[model samples]
Target chain A: PRMKLVLVDHNEFAQAVAGADEAEIIEVIDHHRLSGNLRTKEPIRFINEPVGSTSTIVGIMYRMREAAPDKSTAICLCAGIISDTLHLTSPTTTSTDKEILEWLAGIGGIDSAQFVKDFFAAGSMLREHTPDRALESDRKVFEENGWHISISQIEELGLEEFWKRETELQGALQALLTKHSLHFACLMVTDITRHHSVLLVAGDQRVIDAIDYPQAKEHVYDMAGVVSRKKQLFPYMSHVVTKLDAP
Target chain B: PRMKLVLVDHNEFAQAVAGADEAEIIEVIDHHRLSGNLRTKEPIRFINEPVGSTSTIVGIMYRMREAAPDKSTAICLCAGIISDTLHLTSPTTTSTDKEILEWLAGIGGIDSAQFVKDFFAAGSMLREHTPDRALESDRKVFEENGWHISISQIEELGLEEFWKRETELQGALQALLTKHSLHFACLMVTDITRHHSVLLVAGDQRVIDAIDYPQAKEHVYDMAGVVSRKKQLFPYMSHVVTKLDAP
Candidate 1:
């Protein structure tokens, strides 16, 4: 077998990608915040932007390449942004994020407003969610500076229900970490109304220590005003982790 | 059976509500530019603030009532604003609109970013859409100076598809006018990137005449650099119409 080539559950997706045939992992494009595990031997252009959505990142890449977002891609990416940022209602929304989304709508030839309604209706079927389903529904990969991490987001019914199921979600995530051999695993249980987050950590304490959020010491970071994982949380974590990891 | 409380399909579900006993209409609240066909009682609160979204008008009203949006109501209303203004990306977005949306979010206890994402995703699907769905999804309700009208918005789509489908959408809208006995009907197709709109007029010419776009001629009005239908379009139109309709 070819080194048992496989797709790992979360952060390992990037690690499994390392040292593979150059043709195999020729182009790596992701929109999640930077992870400490990413390294490439070949000279490949890496594009990352702090926008509301990774689909938005892809849209920007297409723009830089002077390529328009295709209809399907546009629809998918817009949905990603809508799903990720909650329609730019989050504090994470910047003028740049809005401008890129508008530009995407122009090239993608779709109405952003209409797409938002349709996309939300699809994702907001909360009545059908199990704790495991809720936990795994939205997972993102991160690779940066040789340490890989994966974070999953769960939008619960309310704060009470979120804590009620935190243990179950942690158990599921722990199983996922062991199964995937991820260096760091996290789940951000965001209380949308309260504007707070419970960052459940399951990995090396050193790695968690490296993240070193002023609010992380409680092991339950209250992102009271932290509305965006992309524009706010991810960028802060990336900088802190990099400074700590710097030799 | 009942007095058959007629309403244009473009009006919001709340705007056309009739009294349970008499089938008499209660109030008219709309943000679409003026239409001359509404015949209501002597007293009504015709609130129309054309800023960015009808939700803005409602927000202002809530403020006037000293009713701060609670966390749930704030998220829903904030979502409405973000959805209506396209995350404040619309040409219609104003500083006031942005400020108000932010204010409502703060009051409503939203995680702003997640709320936006959830709201956008809730409303962003537009694939395989018909002319009717395209036109009806974002309709605004209005009753102004005793004249009631509803304006429907179709934002950010391909010009080719819009042109191909506009005639049909217009026809359907005209059918709505007859059904509701509305005196005026307007359809606005907005280009988010270019900040322009193509205005289609039907119903009363006097009402159409009452509409103020000093630059307007026939159906091809130039709403260049215009973004928010609430802020830019309706305010200009209301000023002109109120001037023209002065009794």
Candidate 2:
């Protein structure tokens, strides 16, 4: 049977679940840039807002309908907001996100400050997983100007673990490039506590040389106060690819 | 100064007002197919639903906010609903449209049946306006597979006015094709009462030949029970344009 789907977090089919192209997309509630490729046989309800997280939009929807989620569901929603907005510190954080987070936190009976602390400490990607697995976590691929690129992001409490496995992570990025026949592949390790990140890239030399961010080392750049892949890194990378000399 | 725009009814930039490319689009409330070109520097509220009329969505929004429009506004909304959905008889009309129309009619103290009748009889485009003016009214341009096409629609009480000016409308469509350098241009004259339309087309011979609707004359096709430009004519024309052999 064909699945009837209501996509929540993302709107682009590339970021959606596998076989999403064949499935019927009945509705979409997202908080991302319109990818412009989504089409439906019939008009569907689409609600997209510019906020820190899709969770915030969902919470707003519930309030509009004069309803509230169950306690556990509220907690899950709170977690989503915290993770996406990094405890309301990320630049993508909006007034709506702040409002919705407070409402959900009250409903969930969660100490949001403690939840943020515990959430960041729960799983350190560099410590808990191999470089390959870390790179695959929360990864997104994009096609721009006929070049296919992949950008993977992993958030940790600090950058301590990233320095330890720098070489291995770079190797994994290279392997990813070859494995996927990508023009470029990048893994952004973000420190949520400090609002900083380090990008390790492996790709064509021309593309790499086009990097405008201050280089910390070979094939690595220090991205200070940059924690958002969607808001910060992706657009920068797209600009680089777009300005490159035709292949 | 760049205007901050709140686009209602339509989302595509092609159909938007001039200088829209330079303006800031802060919000959109629409019920059309996503044209995929809309982008914003900041996240904005976008609400799109598959409904017969944007007035229906506007009415629902008013209800959600626990508010009601004033008398004149209510009547205007009712007229929008009646005109777009052809008095709740178009195939595109949804249950929500019916519900909202009834609500607005009650609030505005409207006789919907009489209003619909008077509205259709008020301005017979074929009789009152020149062919050029008639074709430009309620017209939409679309680009598919490198083919730029225009489809203009005019609703009247019967086919009497259309038969009187078919040749002139055909000439105007040809002029529109040349003026815009379009691949094809069509004028759909719909008899709202009978729920039928006749399409007068002029453009590239290849594209003209590909249209499969039963020909009523040399350059006109009979379209029975077709009152919707968005739901019926646009998609069929798009399919025809997309399937033509590569130029």
Candidate 3:
């Protein structure tokens, strides 16, 4: 018997569940930039949409199947949509996302505005984590061309707060570089109020030189008006590094 | 005022509808291999699916909107699905296509078996046309790497009948190559009964030479068990052409 797999939220072997390479992927429902040259011996259902959240695509899949999600499932998907789109303020939010959120919110019979406010209040506790814990939270690794890179993003209320932790954060990033055998590791500390970010890096010198962005210090660079890491930071640096002569 | 466009079945500036270059595209719904780097100033609804027919994706769109197609539209979409998938037997047909076809067939009150028999019988009327008309009936142009090529597929009852018209068909293919400024052009004469095809070629002898199959003539080769030009012939040759050193 063949082991069958169905991936939700994420695709790509490097980011998928453990033992994914040994299983046959039956379907993938995701809301991310399609990456990795995944080949299978059989055809698979791959639904990747440019939306705010994977939850939005999953909602659509449920609707297409003519099955209403359970109460808890609907609320969970609603939270995912709200979190990923940042209360509908992120540029990554799409009209379809807005529509699905409305449907899910109505099904859950909850005030989404109140829920989002509470969600933000809870997310602002980033000050509690040490630099290492902060880096481990919401971390993702990607392979751009042949360069394997890890990028993590965290939101802070104030730029000064992150700058104070710079030395400790840089140490965590360097540790990640060694642990993952990565060509590069980047951490984006975005100020929620100002909609600007400062990126800290630790990687191969060649990878650092390819950024196109002016570094504020030896390993930190300012990125203005960039809030979404997947949409902005990863794509920007990935294009630059792949165009460079070598990693 | 600005021109707004909605492209159906096809995308890509090179192969888009004429006057598309002068207009701003607002949406693209297609079912072919996704190609071209199309970007816009604003977000648009771009739906590209791995279904057998553009009609299959369109059918899902109609279903998602909760609006049923009229009888004529239902029949039309059903015919498209049946034709493109060769009655759900083509390699390109997906489970989604089968689902859409069944729904459309039910709505249109069609006996799919009878419809498919009539469809293929109608498709095998290539001998009634002059070679020029036959070539123009189902011509499609593609861009691979930097090279542009046109391919036409026709269903015939026998290989000998198509061989008799080879000179005249080659003339038509050469005209298409000159008119479209294509790097190459190919005509696939498929035997509907025997499930074999003889591919005739024009322009860019390097591309023809690159086909792994042994050539039966200067520009003709035997292709056994090959149907679905988009899935089989175009992809196979595109891989070869793109892998070559240069055009």
Candidate 4:
């Protein structure tokens, strides 16, 4: 049976709903670049802006329809934009994102600078949480090149904190990979102070074999200059996965 | 004095506000192709859909914010999209435009077949109205290439009907030129059945001098196959205006 769907935030079929192939996506409001050779059977309302967060688009929709999002919604939207763009410092941050964030900040009575600092400080306490909590907290799942894969990132105050918890984190990731039925799983423990990342990978042997980055140990790779997952890690690993799966 | 502005449907400053420079445009939700040197002082949320009507964008906005438009609003929106797309027959009408129009039709309880026939028949009475009413009914004013200009289009059942009213229409257009202080003005009288247009021109001597088309009379030209104002007339006239005014 043909059914109508209005997709928001995400567009990729993997990230979309279950049995997406059966549904007719009438509209897609997204901020991410088009990927997965995406094509619809019929013409759809596809709005993809080069912005930091999907929350910015929602904010614009609120304004256009002459509806004010409640104070909590404004605050939540503001927080999403700020957190997604790393307080307007992320490479993905667009001016449109900044514009909405500012408007939301006004509505929420938020001092943006103070909020970002507080948010980051709280995030840096990831090392204190149990390994399972850290693994689950910031996890993002994706199916890249027919691989049911996932990559989770944690922003830490120091690299030493991540190194101390490395073994336990890998063990937790292994359990997560099996639990989620993921083809592979990776955790990027990033030092927010130093702007460096240490990747802990656990997955199918083929996926592990495909990646040939500067390996720090058996499954850990030192990704020094990479911070953004969508920009740097996703494309890099997608290439590797594609090459390995090629007939 | 800085204030917030959110532009919809149209993009150009000349087409937009009386004093657009005074307010900072925070967002622009539009459907037309971007024209003029559309540079905002600050970053603005620009949502340009490749659809037929700005009303479709508004319809999408209403749904996104979970705000159901009232019946009257729905009818108006449906009519706007239908009229703008020439009852979903125009080349500029995208699938998204059709999709939104169908939804609006359901909401407004519109009989699409009956509505289109009536709309076209109603529009065909252009020559019967007073010259001023005919001129102002479907007029679009623009500032193209430093020339204050305007284009008015009329849908006619027969070319002879427009030819019958040519002199009076020109007289009213001349008054319009003086009233608006336009450098030039054009009225495109399109024969719906024949799919051809007879353009009535009245303006600055230089603009009249520049047109290389077969001069039907002192101020009329035959556009044998041109029907669309946005697609055919605007761009063609823009080039001519720019060339005539080139320093």
Instruction: Compute each candidate's TM-score over C-alphas.
Output: 0.37, 0.86, 0.68, 0.52
lDDT, candidate 1, B174-244, per-residue tens: 88678777666677777654657777767767777665554454554556666565656555555555555
Encode model 4's per-residue lDDT on A27-135: one tens digit a residue.
7676764443233322234565658888988887677556888889999999788777777766678887888899889989889888887877885545578999988
lDDT of each residue in A1-247, candidate 3, tens digit only: 6688887766667777678878877676776665433444223455667788889988987898898788889999998988787767788988989999999998888898898777766744357888889998888888766888898988777777687888988998999989889989989888776788888999888888777676798899988888888788867877877787655
Superposition error at A193 for model 3 (Å): 8.8
Clash count, one per candidate: 47, 2, 0, 0
Model 4 chain A lowest lDDT segment of ten: A35-44
TM-score of 4: 0.52
C-alpha lDDT values of all predictions: 0.58, 0.86, 0.79, 0.76
lDDT of 2: 0.86
lDDT of 1 by residue, A8-112 (tens): 211124434455443232233443332323222212222333345556656655664457867777767776666667777776455656767787777678877
* Candidate 3 ranges beyond 4 A from true positions: A1-51, A67-76, A88-118, A123-126, A129-247, B18-23, B40-43, B123-125, B128-130, B145-147, B156-161, B214-218
i-RMS, each model, one decimal: 26.9, 2.8, 6.0, 10.4
Which of 1 and 4 is ahead in DockQ? 4
Worst 10 residues of 3 chain B by lDDT: B35-44
Of 1 and 2, the candidate ranking higher by DockQ: 2
User: By DockQ, who's the top model here?
Assistant: 2
TM-score-sorted candidate list, best first: 2, 3, 4, 1
Deviating ranges (above 4 Å) for candidate 4? A1-51, A54-84, A87-247, B1-4, B36-42, B63-68, B123-125, B212-215, B245-247
